[model samples]
Target: MQPIVHPVVGYLCYAGYVRASDGEAPQGELTVVAVFAAVLPDLIDQPLWLIGVTPVGRTVAHSLFGGALLVGAVGLLARRRGRTDIGVAFAIGYASHIAADIPWHVLAGDYHELGFLLWPVTGMPAYSGVKSLGTVGAVDITTLWLEAILFVAGAALWWNDGCPGVEVVRRYVG
Candidate 1:
């Protein structure tokens, strides 16, 4: 999926959580932060790869352990600041990124198997023997179409629920 789609999925996950929470709409900041956290694991591990800390950082960032740590840290920080709700919201949002990616991974034939939920520990490349989909030549029209459908669905959900992104887009278009 493209970068934009990732955040939309994050928002969807956040919305589901909020609806389950107080049975009331979540605060705007919580939704925004959840979407932010969804992509944050990637940002943290990218620097390590650049510095030669690992062979490649993709798996590291895409690991469940990494997500757990981020959640723990966020929870701790929020507790310190007396903002526990924000911390938990971020954690769920971040994990939602993983959840969102899981289906795509399987549909793509478990291409990033090792980096799936049990990566870095199992040492098994989920798609080790399979042809890699991450390669430039591997991307094709089919993948694009699938991603486009998912994006459209996300947009519809966001718009129906009056998500922040919908309002932002409305403001700009108007």
Candidate 2:
């Protein structure tokens, strides 16, 4: 998925977490950070591919270890300020981003089959039966529609429940 889509999904996922945890949704800056964390893994991985790391090394960044480190590091920092919830929220959003990206990448064929899905259990690449999204041959009208809906939903969440404080944190910390 593109950066825009990743962040939008991240916002929605964070909204869900906030609503469930605090009986209120996150707004403003929190939305921004959540979106950023959601796409952070991608940011870490793609550039490395250009440098070449075999299929296995490329998959490492996308795996649980790398993600856990990201979440843990953020959590540790947030703990100093008594904002554990915020750190957890970012981690959750990041996990959600990875989860959401998998299906589409599988469908696209552009995905590296480097066993990212079976972390801790098997380090071998796992191939699925479905064709990759990139292998769809012609235009993917359905994908475009799905992306549009997700974007609108994310925007609506931000407009309705944005918190200026959260945005501030994201801008400074993220």
Candidate 3:
């Protein structure tokens, strides 16, 4: 999925979680956290790869253990502040990124990408094994049809809750 699609998926997944847990859509700053958390993995690893710092998009960031550790560390802070809801939302968002990537990885036979999800339990594969920038861009852009539909679905979910992003921010940050 492209960068845009991750946040959409994050919003929908987080909203669904909120709806499931609270019988209503979630709102406020935590939604913002969830959205950023969803894309944090790609945002982190992609730049490093682009700069030749790493040869892979997936790293410790892509692993379940890594996600858990990140969310857990953030969670501890939130817990201390009595904001566990924020932590939980971010955790779910991070998990959603991994969930979104798995099918694509499997479809592409990028098994090395998947191994990182198991983290220390599975030693890192040396590189993504892709040789060209065009190939990477092609993969991200061309594979967006399903993501387009998912974006629409996620927008509908947010619309159902009255498109709360801006409104929630206004209320909380004003």
* Residues 1-174 of candidate 1: C-alpha lDDT, one tens digit per residue: 345667777777777888897786555667778878877766776587689875565556667886777688889999999998889778877887777656655666764464546666756342332232354565544455665777788778767776654454455579
Against the reference, the lDDT scores of all candidates come to 0.68, 0.68, 0.78
TM-score of 1: 0.71
Candidates, ranked, lDDT: 3, 2, 1
* lDDT tens digits by residue: candidate 3, 25-113: 88877788898899999888788768887656677678788788888999999999999988888898898898987776666666765
All candidates: TM-score: 0.71, 0.69, 0.78
At residue 55, give the lDDT of candidate 2. Answer: 44
List model 2 lDDT by residue over 1-174, tens digit each. Answer: 556788778878888887887898676555666777888877777676557753433355567787877788999999998988778778877887778756665556645553575554555454343342333468645555667788888877777664334657656798
Q: If the candidates were sorted by their TM-score against the true structure, best first, what order would they fall in? A: 3, 1, 2
lDDT of 1 at 46: 58
Residues forming the 10-long window of minimal summed lDDT in candidate 3: 129-138
Index of the highest-TM-score prediction? 3
Segments in model 3 whose C-alpha atoms lie over 4 Å from true places: 107-112, 119-143, 168-174
Record all residue pairs in model 3 with backbone atoms less than 3 Å apart, i.e. clashing. Answer: none
Root-mean-square deviation of each candidate, in angstroms? 5.7, 5.0, 5.2
